[model samples]
Target chain A: MRIFTAVVAIAAGILILGGYFFPAFEGMQALLLNWAVILAGAAALVGIFNLVSVHTDKIRRQEKGSVYSALLLISLVATFLFAMILRPNHATMKIVLSGIIIPVEASLMGLLTISLLYAAVRLLRRRADLTSIIFLVTAALLILGSATLPFGNMPVLGTFVGPWITQVLALGGARGILIGVALGTLTTGLRVLFGADRPYGGN
Target chain B: MIELTIILVSAALLFGITLWKRKSPANLREIPALTRLHRTLGLSIEDGTRLHISLGTGSLLDARGGSALAGLAMLRHIAERTSVSDKPSVASAGDPTLGLLTQDTLQAGYQAAGVEELYVPTSGRVTGLSPFGYAAGAMNISQNENVSANIIIGHFGPEAALLTEASDRDNVTMIGASDELSGQSVLFASTQDSLIGEELFATGAYLGAGASHVASLTVQDILRWLVILALLGGAAVKLVGMI
Candidate 1:
């Protein structure tokens, strides 16, 4: 099983690398990435199956938190029926998802950010680490500068310290992180392929 | 042609450096944060404390990244450790594919540890519908599992607090990280050094004894340095333009 998975992984890697060099093979490369998406699509069943099995078992056994499990089962089935079978138009799905999921998420987002901000302020006042201070100051300036538009009249002033600067900094940081991530991804992938790190049936 | 050559050459250089490190006889360095995680894993099981872990919603098939892989590696570790201790390790998922991969992985972990008899599907659930649903499900697990140790490593969004809050209430030792936007909750709560963005990619390679993962870390380090240089150069050019 490990060997088979490794061979498949190697094939996928080669197709990707080959496509980078040979434009003629770009179509195949595109197909490989597409295969990744398809794999993700197919994997969805794994989670659903898990939910069903767990919740159904809980319901059968009448576990303490079985109510939550039962609710999960009902929600999953309802979602599937509403989204897949009904093929509810975008507006209807949007309303349903937003009405239920969005508000809860939004509340969490707001609460988490606000609480963290308060803690950060206290942290800045207390420990005052150089890095933390820098991060805090930059974030504060960004927020303040953007919210107030302090340099409204002077376009140059605004341009120098405004969204553009933030954009450049954000992009640079993002790019650096991306490079690091890409390398990290390649390395781990190779390990799984080589059977050096077998989380699957390979070892 | 040039770009491809550049990428291949850089990749090769990185691969070489990583291989060199593997050949070295240095003992694996223990990260302080990871040590805490290890301690938490052991303690949870020893005391009948449940451990709650999430592999995020995205599966290996759905979203391919180091974060997803790291989440999986951590899950395997949690499962094996928890199983040996005869403690329940509950896992939750937002992405069904990942949920399945998680179950299989946990089952494998238990099998590897010779504790397959302890494997329970109810312990690892796929309950969340969306990102929020996933968080809610995780929160539920934190409460239900009476989680003693909460270790979350994956691609998570702003909804991180839900689970963290539950852990906090339970007074569980929590360690987590997200590859995407680092949640304020995780930042505030977790003692484990959460890897932001690309740092997450190095996790599996760093933890696993493999050539590819090590090489990837080395290359990633080199690339990071290059990026730093570029940023400095870019800043200098911008300063000059301003002048």
Candidate 2:
């Protein structure tokens, strides 16, 4: 069964990749991609069911935070029913997305910024290497340079150092990381294609 | 056409080297995060606390799939090691498809270790579909489940900081990695020992997935040098043109 699954996966991958290189198989590629998306959707439905079942079981067992589990189930069921009845694009959906989801996510982003700042301060405490010192100094400079002054913006510091730090140093580091990620992605894909690594649960 | 050729040639080189070097030992550089993973797992088992592995919000069909798959490979290794313990390592993913894959990896690991009865469906779960939702769910688990160690490697955004913070609050040993650059920055600040850039992909190799994974890492190193050389060559050409 694992071999069969691997074979199917390889065929699908090849077909999709071939379609990109060969125009003749474009339709077939689209069909296969659609099939994959559908399969994913089905898997997501199963996941939803599993989530509900797990929470239900937790509540049944009277586990810690069972009230939270009950609340989660109720919220999920309510949202599902609303979506089914009122349609997803209704005003209620917009309100939920804009008012509830956006605010919650925004608050989380704020928390992340604070967490990052706190971590920056503790970086030296954790590992006081030269690299850590450099990281801390760079972070401090960027923060100080970017901060608003009482009189006016510190153009020399903010305009110069901020852009240099963010545009040059940060961008360079990010690009290097991105290049590494791309190389890793290619190797991983090739590994799967050549049957070197089977992530689909095969031996 | 050039891109395709380069990919094909690189893959061929990788396969060739893998076959040729299969029997030879791989002398890989020391990765502290990976090295500490074994000890962390042992501590988790000894402490009778769960080891949490989070494969972040990455889908199987998207670009993030590679990282998700890599995380699954790591999951297999951790699961096998923890299969004998009363509480095996638990896995969570933001994507349901990846979640299912995580479960399969767990089951496969247990089966391979001849401890099929230790496999539990609830051990691998899809925490949430959205990034923040997933982070929240995973954070709750890390805090409440008495997690001794939290290994997070996959695609994540800034929301990952929340999980890191939660784990930190609980005094859990956190090792993190992410394919996204922004996520990497967050992880760098937050994790105790974080895998940077392509290091996440090396987890399988470092964890003894197989010789193929080791060979793949070697191939990556070779390709990286090639890229560096190409960049230098391009810069030199521009310089010559200016002269």
Candidate 3:
């Protein structure tokens, strides 16, 4: 069974890749891709069920955050039912997305900024390496450069330093990281295709 | 034609190296994060505290699936280490499809260890589909579940900071890795030991998954050097043209 699954996966992968390069296999690729999508959707439903079951278990056991679990269940069920009944683009759906979800996410973003600043401050305390010092200095300069001065933009800090640091140094580093990730992804995909790493389960 | 040649060459090198390493296993360079992972797993079992592994918001059907699979491989190693312990490692994923895969990996690990009965469906969970929502769920687990160690190796964005911060608050031993650049930056600062760039993909190899993983890492290193040389050559050519 494992061998059969691995063979199917490799064949599907090859077909998908072939479809990208060859016009003849496009239909087959689409069919396989659609099947994968349907499977993903079904898996998502199962995940939702798993979430409900876990929370229900917590609620039943009256764990520390049982009330939170109950609240989460109520919210999930209510939102799911509303989506089914009113459809996704309804005013209520819009309100839920804009009013609740967006705000919460925005707040998390705000928290992230503060947390980053806090991490910067503690970098020295944690590691105290030359790298940490350089990171802190760079961060401090970037923050100062980006901050609005009382007499308007400081040309040296804001215009020259900020742009050079952000557009040149940071961008270069990010690009390097991206290149490495791409190579890693390619290697991982190859491993999967060759049946060496069976993430789809069997091995 | 060039792309296909490169792909075929890489595949050949990867397979050839893998077969060679099966006879004589290649020694991998030390990854401090992986070393810390070994200690963290031992600590979790000794302390009877849970180890939370977040697979991030990578879906199985998308580009992020590669990272998600890498994360799953790490989870399998973790599960094997904790299979006999009362506090087995728990995994969470942002995508439902990946979460299902995580459960399978967890079960496979336990079964390999001859402890299949200990596998629980709830051990692997889908926290949230959205990035922040997933981060929030993972943070809650890290904070409330007596998680002694938190290892996040998956595809994440800037939201990873939230998860790292949660672990920080509790003084949990945190090792963060991600394929996303923004996530790499965030985790580099926040995580005590961060796996940057391709190091995230090398976790399984570093943890002794198999010769194939090691071979893949060797191929990655060779490719990286080639990329560096190409960059330099291109720069030189551009400089000569300008002159």
Compute each candidate's TM-score over C-alphas. Answer: 0.79, 0.96, 0.96
Model 1, runs deviating above 4 Å:
A30-39, A78-86, A90-95, A110-175, A193-195, A198-200, B10-23, B27-31, B59-64, B182-193, B205-215, B226-243
- Model 1 chain A is weakest, by summed lDDT over 10 consecutive residues, at A148-157
Candidate 3 error regions (>4 Å): none
Greater-TM-score candidate between 1 and 2: 2
- Provide the lDDT at A191 for model 2: 83
At residue B240, candidate 1 shows an lDDT of 94
Estimate the lDDT of model 1. Answer: 0.66
TM-score of 1: 0.79
Q: All models: lDDT?
A: 0.66, 0.86, 0.88
Q: Please, what are the lDDT tens digits per residue for candidate 1 over residues A1-203?
A: 76787677667766776886888889999998898777767666765676687778768988678887777678778887888865867677888878977787788777777655555565555345675667677666666565645546345434566576578876676665556656566655555544555555523
DockQ of prediction 2? 0.73
Poorest stretch of ten by lDDT in candidate 2 chain B:
B138-147
Worst window of 10 by summed lDDT in candidate 1 chain B: B184-193
Candidate 2, which segments miss by more than 4 Å at Cα?
Answer: none
